[model samples]
Target: MPASATKSLRVAVLADSDTRWKWGALTAQRLAPAGAGIRLDGYLLRGRATPTARQLQEVGVHADSLREVTGVEFLRAMTEESYDILVLALVGGGVQAMLHGLRHAWGTEKRPVVVTGYVGVVYEKLADGLLLRHGADLVLANSAHDADRFRAVYEGVGAEASAVTEVALPFLGGAPYEGEHDPSAEQGRRPYTVVFAAQPSVPDNRKDRAYLLDRLIGHARRHPEREVLLKLRSKPGEHTTHIEELPYQKLVQGQDPPANFRLVYGHMGEVLDRTDLLVTVSSTAALEALHRRVPTAVLTDLGVRELLGNHHFTGSGCLASWDQLDAGHRPVADEEWVARQGVAADGSYVTAFDAARARITELLDRPGPLPPLTPYYTPETAPGYLPGILARHHLGPDGAPLPGAPAADKAPGAVRQIVRRAARGAYRHGVQRVAPVIRRMGEL
Candidate 1:
């Protein structure tokens, strides 16, 4: 087949870190062969506060294709460039920020289809509802439960219900044997292996990190034949801080973990490959583990409904506590609950690659009416904010501003990079340290 004969599908995936990258990669892979002439190219749109494209290199995300353009540049590209679709691989304020820019650049006549939706398991819908009601042409619902909720909510809110696409968990289903445990593998050699999927940012984990670590350590100590692994969200020196996630390493720093337990990082697939049992408070990783037929237990040690956010798993018959684990209680998988949640018998998601392909093809074949611009960003705000965005990026309708002087052309590049890094580091340090003191001082 001649390359030129194929129809090209150019996609811009705006991502800040690994969470969105996972979805972007999945979407790109699935849409790669939607039609006979379909040719797909996925580009990473990165900016300030985002994990650098280099950090995602290990996951086969190439740095070469990453565009470190500002919000203004993104708007200009969407308005002027030729692209089939643009996916905002983000949620909450991060998404609102881009929608603000898009409001200014969007035109009623010609533009690429804009898409975004909830990227995580929906514990609550209030915050997600606001974003989904924003101007996405296609809003992907991660599960049947979510899809139904999206339709009802959007319809009630006077937004288009047709925009919602019911899809399986994008992280699962497409990849075969992705998280299957392999006892014969070198890393899986332990008699029984357990992986604690940590979500450091979750309030329950942050408040009870020590208790959680102690519980895991005790489990390892009691079952000397078993090895327990703390599967960290990020590695020791890597930057996967998508939304300011606290790495679990900081929690276990001064204490000694048992010999049977250790910390590991990399792809979830590699980590889950050796996992016989999976434990977490309310991590979405439970879905991944369950999909692999690896028994999963949702820890209810710290107020299951109030603090842990594992309330959804309660009816699923996957709930356990540190006390329960200590008493040798392991949760049995409940098929009835699983069916209600729309999870398949083999644990594969209902939304397979074929379904994903069909959905993408359908959206591409029929680009819908342009979404309203001022849903999230008011017309008044765009006027004031758009210029600031342009000035920050040194961009204009013409292009990047011309050099003022010969010295300006030289531009101390390394110094700028160093200063930017220092500023970000200081800001993060302040949030971690000063914020607590300020709050305490206010209370006093």
Candidate 2:
């Protein structure tokens, strides 16, 4: 099939350095209809990525390159262009910045459907940004637990959830696996090799690591032959900065690791490839393990005090609460919560890149009245550099947020390419781009 260039569904993703970016990008691409005319725009916010039409070939997103335009030009494009849907994501003041763009557009034309995912206030103070004040057409609940908390605490925090959703994340899911460890594969050894991995956070915030370490250490001291692995993705700073440092150095075939204690860093994929279990607290990596059929255990350190020092909750483990500590800091699959909490009732199953594309197509094709599914992560466009910020202040100052943002953040070049290329790609896949064309190009 020949490709078309009809950017009917226009979507803008707001992403910064948050991990949610990965989930959000995957969601946008996968949810768009096959032929439902869609155009995706990405704003990197603080990172190196920029969405431009040039990259729309297979990915279907456009990066804007403001390499040459002035700050005024950037603002003009933001206000001048109209979209069908806008997904607000980002940390800190990023949502505020993007809202500036949306407000600019609203000043000139009728507003489009706006959707935003809400992270709890406990995570950060960005919950009351401009987007919320202006009112999002749709509000997103990141998790089911979050929704329940919202309702219980603030009363109205999740009040709009009926019009909102707890979106499914990047793991769009695939055929089920019985788990990577085959009891038949190893004769005289243990039935499963469990592995836990994550980037370590601050010591006070790494209770999951401490808890799991304590339990695994105790188990290892007692058993000594369980083939258990504990891997922590290291940080750039000192060990003292992290919580209860990991144990037992490396895993050797003949080496005694307590009973089952083994700790390492970096290569989680290799570890998961050979394990029957993947354990974590709230780390998303568990999803990676789950995709391959590895059973995962989420444990936070509360009572596992025998093996490590300090107790707090951070890392990626799902063990955020104290009650979970004695229960081995484990969290259930959170399946029903995962599904019903986010943007879609079926949100908890995203995994594959291809599957997400199919979902995105469907989402874009469907008209409003029915809420659009919530996005899992924030989408980012390139930051031209601090120039735009300077321009906004009319300073052209030296304290730029980036090396090249001022220039790259201005032009419409990035979105133009997405419009053209995504249209073509959709056409080839037997999908047609739909256009509401509420108002044509010059109306602004």
Candidate 3:
């Protein structure tokens, strides 16, 4: 197959949340050959972290068709429809379950090239997550450092390491930052803006979150001339890729915020347009900011523990504290570290996906039926662990749909649909409203 060949490719992305959906959709476009037509379809996995309509809108990606589906329902769709590619934008267990189900469903038959990878930094579950995703046709590593780590993990376990392909983060393109505070700019200077990118569950506790919020408010008070924005992932009662038990939105209810401080929610890239300094504990938005040449900080205020995920940025030279930031200290990123982490600050991002594109083209151009999907963990290899993961998705060890799995595939009637919506709303209400009250009562 020629690199310039034009083919209309049908790509289906099964995403569990908004962040993953954005990553998957953009990656589908990036993986396709240049000038090729793409018909993208989306399947949102129904779960606690399933994205709300507003969350999907905030993602700002367009799919030709989009709908929510259960694990079994998605498996059925794969069996019935034909697609050139299937991107599993899911967790490790979800990806593993789908691999087994698809293997059984398409036995000896031609199937789409299945792809899966992490949405951002792989801070935890290094071995467990990689093994669960081992059967994927291409397990994309978003940086050179990750690719090396992935291959090392695979070979350490005596598994094939060829499927790990190096690629840059797909959602990393925006206008380069032009030194927003440059005094000699032709246009009038904009306000010096500091954006704190908030994650859902990094701090994961009320005390740490409130402390960070206070620091942000203090920063606003100290620099009244500057604009401080708390860039939140999702609103109250809405879930993103991770669950937010103690959202900053709720924490700021009674506190008095300075006029310069405010909470803003929109596309991260758009917010970065006027941002002078971007800060986070461990959010992937820091990478986005760095890619666009914006000064980024990964805070070490709480600690550099793995729980905070700030340890992943240890070598990036972007680690700093709120005290340092308040002192007008901007840490320069290490060029060598940035290159290894695949930030693409040097404009190498244009060709980052070339290898992935070529690999997909070769797979699509292959003659005859392709080989069966063989995952690293089999019934023999992981008798105790693999079955539980499959059972959660309504599949047996052999990937056959277990009894009553078809019930999940059935479309709900109008009344049942309404009831389902109400149930989800109640669940969110419990998480946001009731749970906090109960916790406080317990403390008292």
Cα deviation of 383, candidate 3, in Å: 0.9
Q: What is the full ranking by TM-score, best candidate first?
A: 3, 1, 2
TM-score, one value per model: 0.80, 0.51, 0.96
Tens-digit lDDT track for model 1 on 1-444?
322225666667776566677676565544443444333334444443455444565455432245544444566566666666677776455455566556555645555666676556677655455443466666776667777877777677565566677665666542433443455898635466888898746653344777888788888888877888888776533444333334567677887777888988677777777777789888878877666666789987776774456887878778988778766666767877765554554644544445545655555565465444444334343456444543444433222332341112232489876876677667766655566568668979
RMSD of 3: 1.9
Off by over 4 Å in 3: 1-4, 182-189, 406-411, 433-444
Model 3 per-residue lDDT tens digits across residues 1-444: 463348789999999989999999999988888778889999999887889889899999999999889888888899889999899999999999999999999999998888899999999999999999998889999999999999999999999999999999999989998876865578876679999999999898788999999999999999998999999999887888888889898899999999999999999999999899999999999889899989999999999999989999998899999999999998778889889998899999999998888888888878877799999999999999999999999999999889988445466789987887888888988887788789989999
| Per-residue alpha-carbon lDDT of candidate 2 for residues 1-444, written as tens digits (9 for 90 to 100) | 212123556766655433334444555554454554566666544232232322223233233321223323334455567665666555423443444444433444455556555332223233343223223554444455454544343334433333334444444344443544455655644445656554434223224445545566555555444566666543221121122232223213344446456566543445665666566544545555544445555554444332321121223233343333323433334444334433232323443223334333344445544332221112222145323533442223232223343444424577865774566345323311122122233356
Q: Give Cα-based local distance difference scores for all models.
A: 0.62, 0.42, 0.91
